[model samples]
Target: MLRFFFSFLFVQIFLCQTSIAQTDWSKQLDHYISKRDEIDAVKKKTIKNLLKDLQSTREEKNRDKEFIALMQSVKAYEYFVYDSAFKYAQSANRLAYQLNDKSKIAESKSKLSLIMLLKGLYTSSIDTLNTVEYQYLSNEKRKEFYSTAYRAYYDLSGYSRDKHYSEAYKKLGHFYSQKLIDEFKEPSFEKLLGLALQSMVTGKLNQAEDYYIELLNQFNLNNHETAIVTSGLGFIYSDKGEVEKAKEYLMQASIADIKSSTKETTACRSLAEIFYKEVEIEKAYQYILLAKADADFYGSEQRKFEISYILPLIESARFRKENKQKKMFGLIGVLVLVFSLVILRQLQKLRQARKEIVRSNQNLIHVNEMLREASQIKEEYIGYYFNFSSQYIDKLEDFKKSISRQLITKSYDNIEQELKKYNSKKERQRLFEDFDRIFLKLFPDFVQRFNQLFDEKDRIRLKDELSLNTDLRIFALIRIGVNDSEKIAGILNLSVNTIYTYKTKIRNRSIYPNEEFDLKVMAIKSV
Candidate 1:
């Protein structure tokens, strides 16, 4: 019973270990997908450094070092750039031939075959593979040779689309896949990949998924490995009708392929077909275009031919969707245009209303200014009138008293002399002085400002600061809005003809044009 318990414990332990080995790495896969661009950049920088090392090895003139460098360059560029990888592989093959190294020749030919397969030259790839001597290749090179041969036959089978030829090609592919699996003594990435591919081809989807998942868990995969494993899972899920899981895996695979700069990939094309079936036209069109671009970049004629079949269907659907959206947008645009015109018209009306309000405010301000000026004039003239009237009354009373005294003394000559004592010219001169003082009091800067309108040489020079010249007085009245020549003539006690002559003479001497001179005068601000 104790021995039975030990055996049972051993079996349980072995199953537990197997289960642990197949643990899910979904989170790590997500992390790699998210950091695709960053990872791609690092890989590209590594390739750049490797290329520099290749140049240094060539310059050293060491054939062995040169061969190693060329092979390293081929490995570095294998996933990133197929053309460059092919060129390096060819160079390595030539160097190996020149060195007469059979092992190196077989390794270089295996690399060339893989690159040719990626480039859609399937027959050429198979021909190149046939030239490689399996006996001369090392264990690792033999595994690589079998892997490339399996992929070339598999791809050719798909490309042929003929029942007889496809079956024959598929049989050859299975043979190579079995050989690749036989190369490994234990589970490895390549071995597991080969097993998964074999199961997938033999319609053992459950077994294939198990193998791919185990590969994912067993290795810390680079971008290239991640893409291959995820792509296999995607195909398995798709075949099992688990569409959502298929899409998720395919998306991850596509991201991984992009990160590795692997352009010879079918993930995008598969995704395009899935999305197209779901009637997701935009996504289908987008992925189809990306597939076409990758095919073109990788120079894959087979991939291009495959894309050509589905591209037009997705493009037609997308064109119809776009036309429908354009019609809807056109209607919306017309509504927006009408709304804008209405808003613009309302804006114009608002501006006009604002302008009218501004003009009304200006008119009210002008009226208020006129009222203030009129009030000032009335107050000043009324005070002057009272003083003048009082003086005249006092002078008349004194004259009457003097005449009476002369008459009472019977002196007629003395009375006549008293009447003659009053000088009219002197009174008129005093009245003129009062008028000048009052006008100057109303507009203190009137003389200086009025002179500024004329040329410097023609400007009026005042005899005294308190008085204005004839020209100054004429426009000063106009500045106060007494625009009539007749009214100005009456106020200054001069003839209308004299007023006109003074106005014309000053205007002609002014710096401004005749038409604009009055407007400029009016533009002068008041205190």
Candidate 2:
């Protein structure tokens, strides 16, 4: 009886201790979850303290103290803010080099490699890792080196996705990960994580799941660790086609990441992909945009690349769905509107008949006014044409009389001079001047309105109001409805090519585009 009681007590104590341990982790998780919204503020406060310490250490001019300060700042910023983390890591590296400390240099470079990996600089991360001398690194530094190298290769393998290169990258990743695992004792977080990742890479989903579950059970993880573990479970479930379970784990991981202010993460992106495949477009779009924002904030090119494929697909699907809904609503509205209009039409049949008679009378009156205005314009132009013809006839008669007098006197020089005075070029110039004057009289604001189409520097300025330049003349023809290049060229006594050239050059110089310029010219009101 005594032995049995002792055994029962021992069992009870062990169970209680186990329950307390699990409860502790649960409380920590709850605490972070509650403070998710305040994570950024908390991070800022922590960084502020770190900077204060850094400044004090810098003022002391002790290289070792400053180095430690910079490394602390780097660690503080690594998961939340990569740019600052990278800057501090770089400063630490330069200081290490300056101090001629091989161990510090190796440690700093390893930290830099991890930051580079976070920043999607995979090749640079690998290159940076290669520069570190393993012999000079302490055990802890070696662990970091192996871890960075492992992640760099693993991520590079996935990013490539090409069978040829991916296989080689995967092998290197396995090599480094195994090295990392060996650096740790058994049942450690680092060892378990490495084993889980290896199982995942090797296509042992069940084994990977077991490893992750063991990690969760054996450890009271912080926010970062929780994010990592949950994210792994999310991927495993996703691969196993357990969509609901995948989403649950991914959501928890994403929430934890947010609580920790971890911008460099895959949780949000994984959630987006799963939602996208589930055809929950709104959820997918929201998560993808969130993922993109985090990637942009983290400055991770790899994350951006991963998102690029899904984001556009989600946006397009969303647009198509919205357009479909809009079209359906529009069809329904049209049907209702048509039904209403038909009812209204039946009730107002007699009233509409009366309105039609009144509307016809109004349209007839408007047409009469337009015809009267057209007749008046015709009369003015015709009267002006007859008077101009009479004046030209008189001038011709005068020219004939002068020529006859020259011939009778046998003054060949005077005849030659008279012929030269009546040359085609001079006659054409006079004709153009007359046309310009008459056109301007008919539309007084044509030049002013045409100038408005161009910028101040490009506007055409006439030497005199009585004449137009070639460009202005071409547009003037267009304003008068002589839009065809051949017709305008015939009127201006120019080749069709020259007319087209002038039109193109003027339109190119205008503030309006080519297609709109002609329309704008035609829009000019006629007096």
Candidate 3:
């Protein structure tokens, strides 16, 4: 059914082109409104009286009165509202049929067909035109019949793309266009409009511009003529690549359409496409929506399809913009989370380190107290040992004096007996015993502590528990910061070679290396 409709439309277009010139006046919607407003203002009084007379005639219910009223109504609304115009035209047809007025029927049907074409129902327009019997039409009505047919085909040609149909429609439109020209003898507004359309359809843009501009200058164009002229200029400037001028003219046409209450227009759609191509997205979207609303209101399927192409492109661009923003926000959120985690982990580690430092400070404070007590003990022991040594020296001095007096008295037996009683080994033994007692008092657990540094087999076992062995005495001297081997040997009453041998043997048996043995021994706990 759709194919048949389009095919019929194309055929009518071809036929109409064979007899007329095709002009796309839809572009000049603004020019039409500007012209229509002027015409309506001038005809306002006449239209008002006609409407009053029609209402009275309707109330009277007389055949002649009714017939005249219906015709008047059709004529009055022809430029105001197409649907109202069509409705009145149909009323005229019905009245003429009842009155058996064939001429009136033909005129009414012709008017109806033209309105149908304006509504974009090409097949219906052609069918309406076919219903009008040509023989019954008046000479003026016959001319109107051809003129309306020419307009219908002209409009159809604009929407058709088939090369064969396009060419045929163009030729037919030119033929009828010339015939219409023959009907005009002078340079009137209608003639001028027809001439401009003819020139434009034939691609003679300069001629069309001259005619249209001349018409606009000379006469106040009606809504339809203004639409035709301005839209033609817009097309011409667009072809010349004068984008601003073209847009200006198209905008003017659109404004005219708005003021004139004309919904069937191409200017808004054209402007939308231009803005879209120029990447003016917001303007494109605004214009496209307007165009779509107008197209839907106008009820033209072709215009609806044309608008459909641009809507999706703009919507997709909007969606992509929104989607990109969402992704960017998501990435920012992820980055913030990762950064927060990094700071949290650093804070945790810092807290743990602070705890460890506080614990270490507490342990250091306890160790410092132990060292202070040990220092005081060492000082008191040293003072006691020095006092005891001083008293023992005084007693030895008195004993020496007694022995000397006995020897001088010439008693060889007494001197020999005193000398035998005071043996050198026995005196040395008493001195060592006193030293051990003072040393042991200072460090009671010295033997146990010293032996802990070596393996069981390498440990020094003293036969006398009261006295330290040679090696123990050497390290003990080292623990007291007395590391000199000669000083140690003199204090222990041993040879320097024996002291050295004892030091080397103990060091070899120690868990610590040779070089670090003395340091390790010094590091032993004082208590």
Candidate 4:
């Protein structure tokens, strides 16, 4: 049966069997609301509303498989956050791949790369964007891909710490000359926002203002787009030294931007930055602090850096002086150093002792692991023995009974004793293959789930090459409490070498390449 996925026409929707199911968005919303006292902030509040919107549409016209997968992608992205935006982006990228939607793949990868740049992972961001750069697609789809890539590269260059801004400038130029205008001709709320931000980055204040104004007219009065566009325009004006005009727009932008759960952080941050320039110190500090807290919560490296660049200026000089004075306490310092040295010597001795104890513990642990594996193997062996013995014993008992009944022969009493021995053997033999069926059933899914970590290219390269072969499988099983590699080998009908080969292949596929098999095992331990 061909299963249909009914995911209401999200960009880059794809059909696949292993579609992820969307959770009840309302349930999540209520869950957070129930915990409302514990959750407070513009960003979090926005997340809440985003959840509501997604849920609201669940009962709408298009409820299908594709939509569910997209929801899962969104949920997962929100759930597992990091200091870098790249991680969420990567997950979304994988979600796209699973769906077989090329547009989604590009969007996810591009967004992740963009976040990475904001988080100071410039090289990695650039590498990711380049690796997934789109070359063959429809005109609209192609524009989406390059536009994302353009922003990613541009942001990456700006955060590079190195002085080469040429890459960023060039990408910015390309975005302005091509992607921005093209997207504007047929604006998506999401893409429109990006273009507005891009306009500002390229220093095209007039163009930015134009885009913002156009967006304002296009968006519904109270929507996320209105506030985002308004705030963006305010920033542009502020950048060009038009403080009064900037403040006016931002103050107005705040109403829509702050109200919508989708765009409060950027709105708040922009407002804060403008207020600071106006030297509304207390008010400025309040908004900046709000922005800082929001950024930290979301792991927004971009926001963190924005705060960091200006932190020293506003820092209390009195605290600095006090710290300097404390550092100059020479007598106290010498006394502390002496104590520290003594503690260090003691710690070193303690560490050496601990190492000895750990070594002993490790040996004991290894023995225990071996025992557990042996136990499982013993079970399997018993099962096999009982399976064969039960049939054999039954046949033997029947033979004796048949002979006695036919001939009225002597030693009929001995038949019962022989039957008892056979029964005992059968009972012992019944234990093997107890888990074999179950284990085999779970193995396929295990492969799929673990492989899900990689993108299509990674999976294809790894799978076709038989990269995560037997050795890695052995250890992986061990990691999950399957200790008997020999039993595993028996099940696989191959020697231990086959298992070792699998390990080598998996390690080679890793970001850190390893040639030493022993070291690879040690590394897997850490991973």
Steric collisions counted per model: 0, 0, 22, 17
Q: Candidate 2, residues 310-417: lDDT per residue as tens digits?
A: 676776666566656655655665778856555444436644654565565466556656755865885587578789889989989999999999999999999999
lDDT of 3 at 396: 80
Model 1: lDDT to the true structure: 0.78
Candidate 4 off by > 4 Å: 1-104, 114-120, 133-147, 157-164, 172-177, 180-202, 221-223, 252-257, 262-267, 315-527
Q: Largest TM-score belongs to which candidate?
A: 2
Listed in order, each prediction's TM-score against the native is: 0.55, 0.57, 0.49, 0.44
Our model 2 lands, by Cα RMSD against the true structure, at 27.5
lDDT of 1 by residue, 1-527 (tens): 99999999999998666544222333444455457568768878998998899899889999999999999999888766776787788788879988999989888888988887877767667877877788898887788788888878877887676689888988998998887776677767877887787787778999999999998898999977898998899889998998777877887888788778787789989988988988888778777887888778767756776786677677666656755665565566578986655555555665576566556646655665675586577566758968997999999999999899999999999988887899977886777777678777766777778778877888788779997667776777676656556778877788999998988888888999865677677545544
Please write out the lDDT profile of model 4 over residues 1-527, one tens digit for every residue. 12333343332354222222212322332354344334335445655675565556545734333344444444433312443233334444655666677666665665665555545555556666665546434566555456556666555555555566665555654653466466457665546656665667667889878878877788665445566566777778877887666666665554443344331145556766665565555445555665566567667655665665443332322233434544445445567886655555555665576566556646655665665575576456546657766876787788767667745655656656555555544433332233333333334344444444445565533342222444434654543333234655665566767765765566566544342322233223210
Ranking by TM-score: 2, 1, 3, 4
Which scores better on lDDT, 1 or 4?
Answer: 1
Among the numbered candidates, top lDDT falls to 2
Candidate 1, which segments miss by more than 4 Å at Cα? 1-42, 330-527
* Error at 155, model 2, angstroms: 1.5
Candidate 3, which ten residues in sequence have the lowest lDDT sum?
Answer: 19-28
| Residue-by-residue lDDT tens digits, candidate 3, 1-527 | 99999999999988566533212332343355446556446556676788788888888888777777877776665645555566667677767777888887787788888777776667667667767776687656666776776666666676667777776766666665666678656556655666676677778888988987898899887765676667778888887787766777777766665655456677778877776776667666777787787667656655665666667676555445545655565566567886655555555665576566556546655665566587678667777778877887887897788778887787788878877776778767776776676566667787787778778887778888898655676777776645446777888788989998988878888987764565456546545
